[model samples]
Target: MAQGKLERTGFWPGDARLVISISMQFEAGAQPERGASGPFPPLDPKYPDLPMQTWYDYGVKEGIPRMLDLWDRVGVKVTSHMVGQAVDRHPQLAREIVERGHEAAGHGQTWEPQFSMTPAQERAGYLASIASIERATGTRPIGFNAFWLRGTPNTLGILQELGFVYHIDDISRDEPFTVPVNGKPFMVVPYTLRNNDIVRYDSPALTVDAYLADLKAEFDLLYQEAGRRRRMMSISTHDRISGTPARVRALETFIRYAQSHPGVRFMRKDEIARFALTAPGVPRS
Candidate 1:
């Protein structure tokens, strides 16, 4: 219903029509345990559920290695939204992501909802996460995607104060945009869950082929639209889900399919943030 046009000098580097960003959520130590089978899942952990925790570990060990190899072979830069605790636990994991030329963004200190927290608690948690990332990866995180895309009212202000360049929790737009925070620019790199692999967990479709087809279809339509002007596609991936042996093949398939087309560039989220500053039609505050 909102019809518009984005007047600008150019769309992207090299005048590409579409920008593709692949984000992998690295939440090895941040996922909460299975709670009681009640209306609201209680976080009262009575015991250490080693099995569930090990399932997440698979992402760090087997899944991450596979993903690294595949992405390296395909020559793509990704944004890894890693939990601070996970980075603390496996410092080398974050190091590997950075050494391989990928962006490491802050997911959370622990994978918990931030919408209910006080501003002070949220600030403390984010600061802790930033410090952990710096310690492990040698560079502070510049982008953020809170758990479940939830952020407090002061989240944007906090990010600005902490020197972040962008936020990806907002999925309102298909292309990158900017927001004015106290006269400073806060870039928003929108993320999508419709094309995400998490759909396989609860959606009606039961097969990987179906998932792959849907992803291709979405890309095809977006690519078509981008021809009129520049557009961006944010594909959300999870090391624990897409990194699994069975699902990773489909992911690689999608990557290869997207690469086969012209006018497509795979970028890191940080790159999007920096480019958005100069992008056409973005707010200048």
Candidate 2:
């Protein structure tokens, strides 16, 4: 067996030092419902997961508005990975995202895992997700961030067939690169959980201060490297996680710090995808 290496590509728009993308996950109704079908069994016999559902609803009711205001203040365009059912439930929210000039990228029909689905099932889900989002936002997404960022072997091919220009299912590279699908190049815009607010829920050690500090350190290194060899950084957030009052401050602080640096450009995922697809100096798959 042999190993494959991902070479760094010093390419980006406007020859900027670094490309920073703020990715927000809006998965309200898309989350697994109580007693809903999934690869795993329900924790309790209930019709709706009241506790979890309300937590997710808070994002739509308060979290999203607060985050949007912060982003507006920061003057950064973010890419939102939304679930179809969530969009359907909150059509106005979906429209608000587009009207705000942010990019809406696909997540899935629901937050369920895709790896367990058969090829046929995955493809069907993918199509339904695309259609639902388009119906809500009036624009078909050009990029996809699979549920929990998990994807099956068929994800990329299906994405390519469905006209997606890029995918963020990979965290292997800090910079954008190409992966061949159907003998055609597909852009892989890397995503990371390193700076995501979901960490607050999963890890007790990752405090708001810790998350802010980590973001600053990550941005500093990337900004420096980007000077010589253009770099890109992805900051993943959630409406439900980063939308809270305290957590939102951390996100706001990081964006402010990143903005203070020179030659740092904020971009949407679709913008990154198009750049990688058409930019010079980017290596082919």
Q: lDDT per prediction?
A: 0.82, 0.82
Relative to the true structure, candidate 1 reaches a TM of 0.90
- Candidate 1: list runs displaced more than 4 Å: 1-9, 33-45, 283-285
Q: Residue-pair clashes per candidate, as listed? A: 0, 0
> What tens digits encode model 1's per-residue C-alpha lDDT throughout 188-224?
9998988776645345455778888888998999888
**What tens-digit string does per-residue lDDT give for candidate 2 at 1-285?**
234333343467665778999898888766666754332335576566566667777889999899899989989999999888889889899889888989989888876788888888888888888898888888999889887688889889988888889999888888888998988899998998786667544676668888888889999898767755657898888887788898888888888888888778999999988878877767665
Q: What TM-score should be assigned to candidate 2?
A: 0.90
Model 2 global lDDT (CA atoms, 0 to 1): 0.82
Model 2, runs deviating above 4 Å: 1-10, 35-48
Q: What lDDT is reached at residue 105 by model 2?
A: 90
Worst 10 residues of 2 by lDDT: 1-10
Error of 1 at 193 (Å): 0.9
